[model samples]
Structures are given as structure tokens and as C-alpha cells.
Target: MTPRPYLDITPTQLATLAPGTRLIDVREPDEFTGPLGHLPGAELVPLGTLEATLGGWARQAPLLLICRSGGRSEQAARMLARSGFRHLYNLAGGMLAVRATPVAQPQG
Candidate 1:
């Protein structure tokens, strides 16, 4: 089977994602919830273990990967693409940009 390609998403664009979207933060645990904080529902799936955990992840849902400054997440996205993950996205500029963007609050 051919591998799928991943996309690059800016923080502003990330804010547009639907609530509850599966955001995979590929940073170390502390970094995920540390000084940078993290996306509201983003799960901590560090790059090192990402490949092993992919088997159990649902393929249909879009996966958004993030890290300190996008490098790690970019690698993670490529890894997922190689594994045939059809819908993958890397958070461009990572949390730094995410921190600068105004978060889109869920509409009531």
C-alpha cells in the first residue's frame, strides 16, 4: 500500500479545527504540559513512542502532531505518513505560534 502524505498547519489554522479533534502532542511529558502548556484536549504521544502506539489509533480521524518548535512533530508526521496514516498534520511553528494565536473558544 502507498503511504499517505501529511499536511502542515499553522497555529492560526489549528485554532480552526473542530473541538475534540485528536491532537497528538509529540513532546516530552513536561514540555507538553509545562511552560508552553498544551492544546485543550491534545494527547501526549512523544515522538519516541509514536510508532509503536500507532497500531491502536483510529485511522479515519485526522491526527495533528505538535512539539516545542515543529521539528519533532514534522518528523512524527513523516513517520505516520510512512505507516500509511492518511490524515496527518504537523503544527507549524509549534506551541510558540500556538501561544501567539488567539484560541478559538467553543461556541455554546
Candidate 2:
């Protein structure tokens, strides 16, 4: 299978996602909600649950994978790519990096 393109983006790039793009948070629910709220519109699909969730995802649009740092998301991105997700993106430094950027705060 052809490898999908993984776009590495910063928090600023969130605004650039087109309407159909999928934002997936690979962190556990606790981690997502603990101290750092999730990105608005991001679907909470932890890494362990990605495969099951993939059945319902849109293969056409890019899947933006995010985690605490970038590791888990990158793994998730690769897993999805192997499952034939044509477009994938890894948040360069995850949510922490995104939060550090000067962007509009996301409402929980």
C-alpha cells in the first residue's frame, strides 16, 4: 500500500483544516481532560482504540493525530496509514506545543 502523507503542523495550522478534515486526539480521556483541555472539534480516539474507530472515519480527508507530546500521535498516524487512510497529519509537538502558541483559546 502507498504510504499516506503525514502533514506536520503547529497549533496555528488548526485554523487551516478544511471542513472535512478529521482531528483525532490519541491521548487517553483523562490525559485529554486532566489539566489540558482538548482541541475543539477533536475526536477522542485513544491509541488503543484507533483501529476500531477507523471503520467510521473518512479516508479521503486528512486525519490529524495529536497526543501529549508527538510520539503517540505519530504511532497512531502510522497505524492509520497502514489501514489505508490516505491523508494523515502529526501535530509536530502535540497539544502542549499547540497550547504554547499564541492562538485563540479553545472552549471546552
Candidate 3:
């Protein structure tokens, strides 16, 4: 009905992840590999190219968007929501908070 809504959650709260959750880092390549190392299994997909990258993903696919701060990731999550992804997650505070407080690995 309202399309897949964007869900904002802190990195720590996301520890208990479900299987098939896709981690997408929307920061620039340099930033992703520069200082704040990305999430454990995040794929580097710059924000500029996000739309094209989603071409092959299923509408129901789960996506977790990340960036330097919460801004870009939230934008990405909204973008995914527009694209019809049923499950969307935006990393609140992004890598900044992740660096301050380590994010737990996804539970099995």
C-alpha cells in the first residue's frame, strides 16, 4: 500500500540480524576504505550509483544502508523504499556511531 517503509535503527540495535539482510555502504569508495572501516559484510555501493545497483535485486530483498553520518544512509533507505524494497534499514548515526561503539555481528 504505502510501499515499503523505511526503518531507522541504531547500529547496536541491529545486532540481531535476520539472514539475507544486505548491507550497503553508500559512502564514497575512499571513505568506505579510508578510516571508518565499513560494517562486517557491507558492500561498497556509492550513493550516486545506488539506483543502478538495485536493478537486479528482488522487491522484497532486505537492505541496510550506511554512510559517514546518518544523512546519506537515510536518503538511500528512502530511495530503496521508493524502489519497492519491502524491508529497508537505515543506520542511525552511521559509521560515526559504529566506530564509537562496535556493532555486534549478526546472530545466527
Off by over 4 Å in 3: 1-4, 102-108
Q: Which window of ten consecutive residues has the lowest lDDT sum in model 2? A: 2-11
- What would the per-residue lDDT of candidate 3 be over residues 1-108, giving only the tens digit for each residue? 674378888867777667889999999999999988898889999999999898998888788899998899988888888788878888889999888885458999
Error of 2 at 99 (Å): 1.5
- Give the higher-lDDT candidate: 2 or 3: 3
TM-score winner between candidates 1 and 2: 2
lDDT of 2 at 90: 91
Clashing pairs in 3: none
Q: Which stretches of candidate 1 lie over 4 Å from their true place?
A: 1-4, 18-20, 102-108
- The local distance difference test score of each candidate is 0.85, 0.84, 0.87
lDDT of 1: 0.85
| TM-score, prediction 2 | 0.85
User: Per-prediction TM-score, please?
Assistant: 0.83, 0.85, 0.87
